[model samples]
Target chain A: MLRVENLSAWYGEARVLRDVALRVDAGEVVTLVGRNGAGKTTVLRCLMGLHAGQRGTVELDGRDIGRLPTHRRARLGLGWVPDDRGSYASLSVAEQLTLPPVLRPRSSAERTGLAWSLERVFEAFPVLYQRRSVPASTLSGGEQQMLALARVLRMGARLLLCDEPTEGLSPLLVTQVGDILRQAKRHGVTVLLVEQNLRFATEVADRHYLLAQGAVAEALDNSAVRSRERELLAYLGI
Target chain B: MTGFLQNTFNGLVSGAFYALLALGLAVIFGMLRVVNFAHGAFYMLGAFGAYVLLAEAGVSFWWALLLMPIGLALFGMLLERAVVHRLGRLDPLYNFLFTFGLTLILQDVVKSRYGVQSSPYATPAELSGSVDLGLFDFPTYRVFILVFAVAVCALVWWLLSHTRVGVVVRAATERPELTRAFGIDVGRWVTPVFGFGVGLAGLAGVLAAPMRAVNPLMGADLIIVVFAVVVIGGLGSIFGSVAAGFGIGLVQSWGEAYAPPIVAQTLVFIVMAAVLLLRPAGLFGREESAA
Candidate 1:
């Protein structure tokens, strides 16, 4: 389980994340939906400790991790998939997959199953296997996205903080990602996703935190989000 | 023609030093984004280490070669932890300036100890004579230096390409912050990498002791050329720096043979300027990763 309480963030003088609070229980997928500049990324950044200009309490499985550095947060099973599929141009696809050293899960509760082996990861994404020997930058956008997500999964990250993983991806690729996330959730991985596509959000996430101007505007379950989809889209200017 | 061949051999020998030095520079720069102005000082230290070992402790060239690099590597790691890493969050330029200041201090320390005079080191008895190349006879020691440097470079290259640690280090070099987010303790590797880079410089310095004058100012003049080689190769590209090192060596040799003294002196800078104009990111460099 992951929890954030009163997480206020700032980019210098300008505040980004207002006193925001949210939580994702184990094996659940939650989404934070917002318009452009609504601090969706900022919220993820703060959770990952990439943004230090903030005051917040981030707890992972009852242990306060707010003071940890990014790598320490990562050791606590915090995996980040930034909006841009972060891939090293110099590293091959296989190299990228194996770059992050597999660390033991910090909390016993967070450890659910075996981390994905190279063989398993290769089996999960056959296209990646086909192009494993090639540089990661040469992979198409969708392929790179798969690499990013698959890397964290292989690291056995208990909680994934994904920022707009579906953005700029083809619909087919988006569907593939949804399947991957569902598969991850089945294996006891919890996710805190930031997505703009509410329809896709409803399909994958059990609950949605509608983030507007850096604060949680509404906490809606799947049915509520579906009922208010049209109004929400218009207000989000999407 | 014999003179030409000998000069070519000399050029390649000089290039081996540059390649060794620049390889360290590129690795350090790639990982830390700091331009290590003290690289030459370490090179001088390598030579002086060999010289002093023989002079004070009666340690031989071979032993110095093995020990100097390792000793300096440990020293480098200590310095990084004790001083360099303290300013990690500041601008990268702070490290650059700090390294430059370090270089001056190192040079002065050596100068104070030995005075500005050149120190002599006897060539190893095994490598005292010349070996017959097809064109001309070359010094046995020069041949050993060439072969040794190339073998070391190849070993380093293979280690980087094939090892898991190498992949992680390479990935970290390419993307430091993102690598951390992927659950990598990139900081854990930084000190060792920095130390390894310094070791390479020290290794190059040990190689230089026999070939060049063992004076405090030896690295002062040579480092400028090595920097040019790095610039031509591309700032952070490891392979680029090595290629540029050897390439500049050959170019300078030919320039010295065929052209005037001033042209030979300016050849590397001219090539660097041309490379900068043609490929600003360097021959091997790509534009910033869109992360």
Candidate 2:
């Protein structure tokens, strides 16, 4: 469960996010669908306490996380996967997977029940296991995405904030990402995803928030999003 | 053949000191992204620390060797916390300039206190005698310096490559944001890492005390040469700094034997310029992309 209210962010005098409000329930996959510059990434950064000039309260499990540092937020069970994948070029795949120390345990039984392990991650993405010793930079785009997802999972993150996890991924890799999201849902790891891909978003997310000009324009259930696909597609200009 | 061997041996002895100094520079530069212009000053402080412990406290050279680095490390940590920490958010050039100012202040203080003349440190009784190798006899202290430097370098290399702390340090060095996201407080490590780097510089100074004249300006002259070695080896490269330090030392030694004095003095700079021209990143250095 995460709640963000009246969140505003700036990049050196230029306001990017203006009074944005959103919420995600426990064990649910919620997506913020927007075109470029809709402030989706900015919202995630604000929630992570990474945006240097940010305003408004971000609550994780009813605790105010807005004032916390990025590392503190992470330690409180917030995991972020940036659009860039943020892989260390010099670190091996295994090192990247193992480096993130797990934060404090979540109180939710569903989250605590799942057996999150390196072996499980390897089973999910066998290609990573094969190239475990190889440097992260040497991996292909799809592999890097997989590595990014696997990394947050390794952190035992209760709430995962993923930005464009499927961007630049192949159709097969996109499908795999969909399957991973499904798996995450089954494990009760709540995901707040920022996506441009409507089809992928619809396939994975239980609810969708359409963002326009730095604010949430509409919030739609999965079925409503499917029925109103044409209008949403036109709005997204995809 | 004997003369050549003798020069090579001397070159290696000097190279050990250069390697030790450059290794510390590499670690500080790599982690903090600060050039640490005061590294040589820290080295000078290390030698002085040994001198103070010996002269005032009547501590033995052996004890000073162990105690000086720890004391200097604490001092370095304080300096980093009080001064360097403030400069982290500013341009790295600020830290460089700050350290340059520190070097000047430290050198001046030492000069005023100790006077401009070099002070001598006696060799430890155990390491005073010369050993006769087949080609020539060598001072026991020089041999100790060579062996001790190599051992220290190996330990540092192992610590960087093999340990968990080292892995975290290396990871943080490459990607601070991602490391933070992983719940690591990378900021906490900065102070200790800086102290450790300066401690290595101090250790080198302790090693140099018996061999070189312990003077305020001693580091000023050597720091330039060390910088040249770091440039040729590649900035922020651990192995590169070590290799280049030794390589440059050897080159300088051979030049002294084979070439004229002025040419010998200028040789390291020429090699540095060549490396910069051929590969701006240095041999082991990665090209830093604009952040």
DockQ of 2: 0.73
Tell me the lDDT of model 2 at A210: 88
DockQ of 1: 0.78
Which candidate should be chosen as best, given lDDT against the real structure? 1
lDDT of each: 0.90, 0.88
- After best superposition, candidate 1 residue B141: deviation in angstroms? 1.0
Model 1 lDDT tens row, A187-232: 8889999999999999999999989898999899999989998999
lDDT value, residue B77 of candidate 2: 94
Per-residue lDDT of model 1, residues B18-59, tens digit only: 999999999988887878899999999999999999999999
Name the TM-score of candidate 1.
0.96
Question: How close to the true structure is residue B74 of candidate 2, measured as C-alpha lDDT?
Answer: 93
Off by over 4 Å in 1: A103-114, B1-4
Model 2 agreement with the true structure over B1-291: per-residue lDDT tens digits: 889888888998989988988998888887888888998999999898888889889998899899888988899899999999999889888998999999999999999999989888999999999989888998999999989999999998898777778878888888777688788898998989999989988998998898899999889889999998888888888899999988988999999999999899899998998899999999778887665
